[model samples]
Target chain A: MTLFQQILTIAICAIGTMTTRFLPFIVFFRGEETPKYIQYLGKALPGAIFGMLIVYCLKNVSVLTYSYGLPELIGIAVTAVLHIWKRKTLLSIAAGTAVYMLLIQFVF
Target chain B: MKIKALKAAFPHTIPILTAFAFLGMAYGLYTRVSGLGFVYPLMMSTAIFGGSLEFVTVTMLLSPFAPVQALLMALLIQARHMFYGIAMLDRYRGMGLKKYYLIFAMCDETFSINCTADIPEDVDRGWFYFFVSLLNQSYWVISAVTGNLLGGFIDLNIQGIDFVMTAMFVVIFLNQWFKEKRHLSSWIGLAVSVLCLIVFGPDSFLIPAMVCIIALLTFLRKPIEGGEDKV
Candidate 1:
């Protein structure tokens, strides 16, 4: 691809991405009374969205494969436990990631 | 004032600093190994900040150019951002000029942190969010440049460090799980996504999972809104 085409392709991507990010704001601007359904969804969607995100992150973890996803399983467990026990977001993430790194790099 | 907000937001962003540093380096190395100059990765990361799409763009660049296909694929891959935009409508409202950048830079991690983290009352809300977005972008860009410049010369055993992203999401999920009284929505999200993943496979499960999630959540609106226990 020429430099022009490459730039165009990347620009297309950037534009596409900006569309998604800005679409909701464009559709539901604060100047007007937002619909009740959207408002409800706005309130309710985060819980599920967060859940879906978690699943998204783990989408590739195949339990039937080699190592049987043990690393992910233990990693998630450690992360969850540390978060719940300490209630410190950064610390829990750091600890869990550290454990997973050690497991995959050495123990696994 | 901006400095104070930056100070407040920086600590929360430390995990991202680590994650993006390595991830960005990987991205840079990928571009470098592909025989592209540092300019490509730098510009891609700056303009198209979404991690997955940036990775995808690498292959697209190598392939025969198809502008329309590239655009459509980008839209499809990034459709999830629409959800984030909707979810953030209220909080991001009244943010003024920072609002535009906030929306533009709303990657998965940024959205998760800004959405959930309780910024102190004293900190400037807009600035706090601005710092998060800005700092995250800097980490990614800097690391990408480093990797491109170093070009496979650096090696470290950071094999599973990518799990940091997963761990971060899991931690956020747990935070939301405990905060809400009803686990119905959370469960629906997990079950539906897993179901979609199994049925559709990982490659194309996300859109279907998102659609299923929205459909189910809309269907359960009466009970979910009324209260989960009432269902």
Candidate 2:
């Protein structure tokens, strides 16, 4: 793409991102009562987002029942246990990723 | 104050850096593989800073796809930020002129983390928010540049790399889940989305599922438990 094209795409993306991210603030955030609907969204959105997120992360892994499933499953299990146990973000990622890389490189 | 703000942002932006750096490195390396050089990642990072959007950009660029289609898809994928913003109304309101940075930095994790954090009484909210925003972007830019440069030297079998963000989301969810009450609507969302993905097939289900999730969550607000049960 041309320089102009990159700029235009970036502009559209920035605007779209900003609108979705910032517009809600200018509308509902200024007042007394925070909308109950918004409240409900906050409660529920993360779960749905993360649920999709898990699927998204695991999507690339081929699932012929058990062929390439070990590493991904182990990674998830490690991450879950570490997170629930340690509650340390960096450690969870590092340990999980490290274990995963090691598993793929050496184990499976 | 500005300098302090900048400094303050560095520490809070650690996760952003850790997460984006590997991805950036991968992107840069991919640029190398795609018959490009350091200039590509640098330029893309500087001009187009969106993380997943950058991946989409690579796909579109690598193929014969039109820029218009790539651009639309980028926006649609990032549409979830609207939810992030809405989640941040209370915090964003208190921010003064630094609202610009806050808005820019309100990417997925920063918003989620900040929403959970109890803003201290005496701390400068603007600086706190600005610092995280600034640091996160810098981390991404730096990582992408590094990855591009390192691409030549490394032969990384980096498939499934993009899933780090997804994994991070799962980590964050699990982190929050045990602390917080069950969000029934989101479970409903998961069920509905998987069904949609199966029915519509992978290509067509995302936007529809997201729409269904958002609509269902919005409506389920009143009956569900209050959003804040944990930190």
Candidate 3:
């Protein structure tokens, strides 16, 4: 692609992305009462979204492949356990990532 | 007020700092190796700001110049942001012009932290969200540029460090789980996502998972709102 074409492609992507991000807000514009259904969604969707995000992060992990996602599973276990035990967000994330790094770098 | 909010928001973004540094650099390196100049990754990272789509965009840029296809692919890949927009509708309201940037910068990480972070009452909510979004994007943009410049010259033994993103999401999911009284939504989200992933494969699973999630949630709205399931 030419330089102009390349820039256009990136611009197209930017527009496409901003469209999805901004559409809902434009439809539900402020100061006007949000729809009952949308309001319900605003209250209910975050929990589900968080769950989906976890799965999204691990979407590429193939259990049938070599090592079998063990590193990821163990990492999550450490994270959950540490978070539940201490409730320190940073600590849990750091320790879990550290364990995963060690596992893949050495154990796996 | 802005300074206070920035301080409060900084800690929440620390994990993103580490995760984005690696991921963004990897993206930059990929772009550089793709025969593109550093400007491509730098501009794409700054303008697009969505990680997955930006990575895909590199390939799209390498291919034929299909603007329509690029645009559609971008919209489809980013459809999930609409969910974040819906969830944030109320929270982002009345913030004046800042709301525009918040929505524009609402990548998965930014949305996750902004939606979930417990901002102190004394701090300004708008500024808190602003700084989190700004800081996260800055990490991504700067790292992308650095990676493009370094271009395979540096090799670190941090192979699995990308797991920080997964770890962060897991912790966030667990936090949400502990906070909510009912687990149905969380269960639906997890179960449906896994099922769709298996059925459709990772590449195309998200939209299906999202569709199923919304449909299931709408179907169960009555029971969910009625507070019938206390478990």
Candidate 4:
């Protein structure tokens, strides 16, 4: 692609992205009361979104593959246990990541 | 006040700091090794700001020019942000000028942090959100540039390190789990996403999964809001 074409491609990608990000804001503009359904969704969506994100992160892990996703499973388990145990965000994340790194590096 | 917000926000972004520093460098090296100049990664990271699409943009730049395909693919990949914008409407409504930038920088990690973070009452809320967005973007840009400049020389055994992002998400999920009294949405999200991952595969599952999640949530709205399972 030519330099201008590359820039246009990037610009196109940027526009697509910005549209998604801005759509909700524009539709539910200021001074207008947000519809009841969307309001309910706003209240209810975050928890689910967080869950979706968790799954999104592990979407690439396959049970059929070698190691069979054991490392990811173990990592998540450790992260959950630590967070539930200590209630510290960074502690759980770091410990879980460390366990995964160790499993892939040495154990697996 | 801004400094205070930045201080409060920085700790919440600690995991992102680690993940982005490494991932940004990987992206930088990938761009550099693709025979592109450093400017490509630098500009993409700064302008696009979305991690996955920015990586995908590298391929788009390499391929024959097709602005239409690039735009459509970008929309498909980033459609998730629409959910984020909806969820954030109320929180971001009154944030003034910072609101625009917050919306602009609403990548997954930044959205996760700002959405879940319990900003202390004394801290400036708008500034807190702004700094999180700013700091996370800065981390990506800095690491991307560094990776491009220091290509191939800073190799470490970072093989399993990408799990940092996964770990971060898991922690956020757990935090949300503990906070909400009802687990229906959480379970629906996890189950639907996993099912979609199985049915649709990783590369193509997100849009389907998100659609399912929204449909199911809307279906269960009455029970969710009826306070039968209040959080």
Clash pairs for candidate 4:
B181-B231
Report the lDDT of model 1 for residue B120: 95
- What is the C-alpha local distance difference test score of candidate 2? 0.65
What stretches of model 2 exceed 4 Å from their correct place? A1-12, A28-34, A65-68, A102-108, B4-98, B108-132, B155-163, B218-223, B226-231
Quote fnat for model 1. 0.81
Q: In model 4 chain B, which range of ten residues has the least summed lDDT?
A: B222-231
How well does candidate 3 match the true structure in TM-score terms?
0.66
For model 4, the superposed segments whose C-alpha errors exceed 4 Å read A1-17, A28-30, B1-41, B50-103, B106-136, B147-151, B227-231
Which whole-number lDDT from 0 to 100 does residue B146 have in model 3?
Answer: 91
Chain A vs. true chain A, TM-score per model, equals 0.75, 0.76, 0.72, 0.72
TM-score to native of every candidate shown: 0.67, 0.71, 0.66, 0.67
Off by over 4 Å in 1: A1-13, A28-30, B1-41, B48-136, B147-151, B228-231
Candidate 2 residue lDDT tens string, A60-86:
456666455888888778877988888
True contacts kept of each: 0.81, 0.40, 0.75, 0.80
Q: Which 10 residues in a row give candidate 1 chain B its minimum summed lDDT?
A: B152-161
Better-scoring candidate (TM-score), 1 or 2? 2
lDDT of 4 by residue, B40-107 (tens): 88888888898767766876787677776677668756776887887788889889888999999999
lDDT of 1 by residue, B1-231 (tens): 999999999999999998787678867766776678889888998998987678668767977788876786687567768878877899998999899999999998899899999999999999999999999999998888787777756575556655766776788789878877778888998899899999998666767877788899899998788874353
Report the lDDT of model 3 for residue A5: 94
Residue B191 in model 2: lDDT:
84
Judged by DockQ cut-offs, is candidate 4 incorrect, acceptable, medium or high? Answer: medium
lDDT per residue, candidate 1, A1-108, as tens digits? 998999999999999999989988999786456588776776577778767767777777889978898999999999999998998877787788889889888887
